[model samples]
Target: MGNLVGSWRFKEPSTVEECDSTWGSDSESDEPVAEDDSGISDSVSPAESERAPGHSGDTSPQLSDSPESAPKMKRSFYAARDLYKYRHSYPNFKKSRQPNEYRNLRFYLNKIPLVPDGIYIEEILSKWRGDYDKLEHNHTYIQWLFPLREQGLNFYAHELTQDEIKEFQSTREAKRRFLAAYSLMLDFYGIKLLDKSGNVARASNWQERFQHLNESHHNYLRITRILKSLGELGYEAFKAPLVRLFLEESLCHNTLPNMQHSVLEYYVYTIRLPATRRRLLRYARKHYRPAHAFLWGPPLKRRGGGVGPEGGVGAGSSGIRAPAPTPEQQRRGEDSPSSPSASSRIIVSSHNAMMCQDLAGGGHKGYAGLGSSMVGLEGTILMAGAQRDRNEYNEIVPL
Candidate 1:
């Protein structure tokens, strides 16, 4: 065994005649070297092997000299070795390159099996896409589904084609499931919608099912769809509804007021479409007034005066019973004032004697006498005396 471990020395045949003579023995050797049952010596080298009986020594004329076999054999051997190595390393390689948890979640969500529960679907989709940045962060799964929600809402609202509706329904249903699961996960992680009411207001199905959803959810979905639609339209048509919804939700929930206001500011700053910024500003003014004031202060009130007193304009004082100026007052601004130099004015008078007579059948004849001294005054006058008299008279009058 030791000798076998080292290199072996063999005698070399110097000449073809010497090789043939040494290997040509037909009789078995007395030494009885190891031989197979066939009586052929297994210990003999190729050079020492004997030719078969009656065989010619000269080699047959060469037919083909193709080198393809050797190379093919070598390639096959190498390929098999490489395949074994790849199989051994495959798991580790894949594990090392595996995506993160959120990515994996998205991957699974995108392929979630469909079922009958639309609420479950919506819940899952909302859970994943409901957050401010999650939809963008896990865009791989959420992006494809978001547009579908919008489309579904639009189709449901406008009654689009069946094919279009089906397409949106499929996406919406998938997204819904994803959101539901995601919301559950968030709950498990100790994250929650601002509150139950907020959650209910924002819920996509709230209006359809008359279920309260979180307003935050509503704002999130609304803003996201608006942004997506704006992107689709090359940001040409600015939708105030989205901004308005966001502002309203923010005001209702009082969360991320700055963010909501920022959205409004973005609308005012970036959108160049006519009335787009104004509408957004109006919405922001209505709901995000605090944030707007913080950032740029309240909008400067229009300086020119028209109706009622400079700062005490109101419904009863303006004799209109509405905050907005009445049609007559609007028209009166254009009419020539009694004096050319007098500034345009809005008149707020309690019902005049004629109006009182018409409405009350002259019940309070003395009520009209109160305004007798100021009958020709161009400015508005609140008929406190007339209202008092009417109330007093009404108390005495039979129902």
Candidate 2:
């Protein structure tokens, strides 16, 4: 018991020098004590000497150097952070009865198993057999969407069976995911955005329809997320509405700038071409970045700016829903930038349009001021507007 340290503290000095200083004693002190990391500081005062009456001050006990007695190093944030989060969830497949929370390091080590994404998803689809009615979990569907899209395969939307489409249409959340998928399609392939008979499907008032679809706040968020994904994927299909969101703040009314930040972040960090980046940056407010900077990097410094190629929203919707916007609606949405506020936006819309037209072989030169940001796009206005009945919001937007 005499060899034991008198007391301990929570203070963890990160360096040897710091540890020495932390444990350093003044010329006259004789007590051994430590400061608590939980905000308490305590060092035995000289008046509280261990010896009674005439005992010598040099009799103080020294800290031992045994393995168990040595001060332990505290955990580092870099190493413990993820483990901390996992521990809280503490995913035990047996206890949770679900694999959703399971995150075995081995799973990460083994890898997703390299294979043709399309072929892999197709094989899964075969067994699933386009029937989502009885499936309680959608993880299989989720696994299929993300990896394939990451590989830049946007046309995967066309592969969905109608019965599978019905499964997504069954609920609002499902529809939102579906919207994300269609947005992926537009990002990679904006050409297949129409049909002749598709024109008249939205015989109802267009503006009203747009409002109704966005009545739910979640739907609005999904819409903006998809638009940002469009820019990230280098597709110009929906740049008009994308521009409108920033042009008229009212378009983003009652919602946080999540969508706005997403669009700006993509433009700032993901857009590579200087001219295209400059074009997008023109619409960005001076302090816009402080609102919600992206995870990619710090807010871009002046000298200029831009951002995306991989990772996206999800699967495209097939013919189960409404058509794209009509030419008239598109022209209205793409009206030439007349106002100062609208000019920068015009460049974006026009540039995106030019891309679509080119990709779909619309037969024309690239947009004059487009540069690389607007590269290879051909269908210009493939998507006009999306539709969903009773505010459920359909994923298959026109374009």
Candidate 3:
């Protein structure tokens, strides 16, 4: 506010050589201008006049432009080159998610706590890649291969190429051949393969089969076959070793009966043993005991001249006879009157008598009584004796 137009302070002027040298300039001074004229000259040449049409005569402003600006141009050129190179190098990169897919597969394969899906895929892929063409005619091999191919395609999705699909299909066929060959070898050597299914396929000639296996092979025919058989039967064949270990412990420790039952049921179902036969035999023996008494034991003799322990009783031989009670014994004669002041009386008669009522309630009938007449006779006599005593004035009587 005090001096909007300040005084122009000037430093001592330096020579052109001194200015060039101080500023590290390499240009040699070919033309010199008078310093007192403020670097402006009135001398004009024909060549300068001719250039004035294109030039603005603003040379003093050119001092602001320096070599530092050259770097900006260079940087721009390099940046353009890098962009071009990147575009050329990855023309179809955006179309394929191969990198992500591969990365994800590797991550899951490495990070999974249990058997990774990638392992199975890799196995199938490797096998298919080996010699798939040969397996085209194998129905069983094809049956197994198609499902695996579908699974791989579904899993990898857009990441895999047509070529890769073909290769994978081939690899599956190769794996089938490998498995079959391996299985045959195990069979030749009398080995067996275990699989998830609780089924067993024995290699009758395992020794010969062993010779065909190599370091690259999965070489688990016996175990895999066993597992496959077990799996087919819906058992946990993969856990067979653990099951066996537990069973061994139970047998050695003499654990509870229930432990044995569990082991038996598992073994019967998993191993397909003859457990049901033993169980049926046990049940049959239990029910057979009562039948044995009537048909084979001493109770057979009570049925009257029936078959003896050795053979049927001779027709001529008389069996033991049961005695029958006499009429006086049956009536159980009443006590004589005046002997001990006793009187005879009928407890039950046609009148005021309780007739046996049939369960069907058709009419009054003789008592059915329990068992044979011999058992009933004993009960009736006791009733008669009590009635005779009651009639003698000892007590009131009723039939």
Q: Give lDDT tens digits, candidate 3, residues 297-328.
A: 11123333334323522111111122333566
TM-score of 2: 0.22
* Candidate order, TM-score descending: 1, 2, 3
Question: Which residue segments of model 1 deviate by more than 4 Å?
Answer: 1-137, 141-201, 204-231, 234-238, 252-258, 267-272, 286-399
How big is the positional error of residue 27 in model 3, measured in Å on the Cα after superposition?
Answer: 99
| TM accuracy, model 3 | 0.15
Model 1, C-alpha of 224: deviation from truth (Å):
6.3
The TM-score between candidate 1 and the true structure equals 0.24
lDDT of 2 by residue, 303-357 (tens): 1222111121110110011123467745754674432232232223222233343
Where model 3 places Cα greater than 4 Å from the true spot, the runs are 1-116, 121-228, 231-246, 254-262, 273-399
Candidate 2 RMSD computed on C-alpha atoms after optimal superposition onto the true structure = 30.5
C-alpha-based local distance difference test score of model 3: 0.26
Candidate 3 lDDT for residue 62: 14
- Give me the candidate number with maximum TM-score: 1
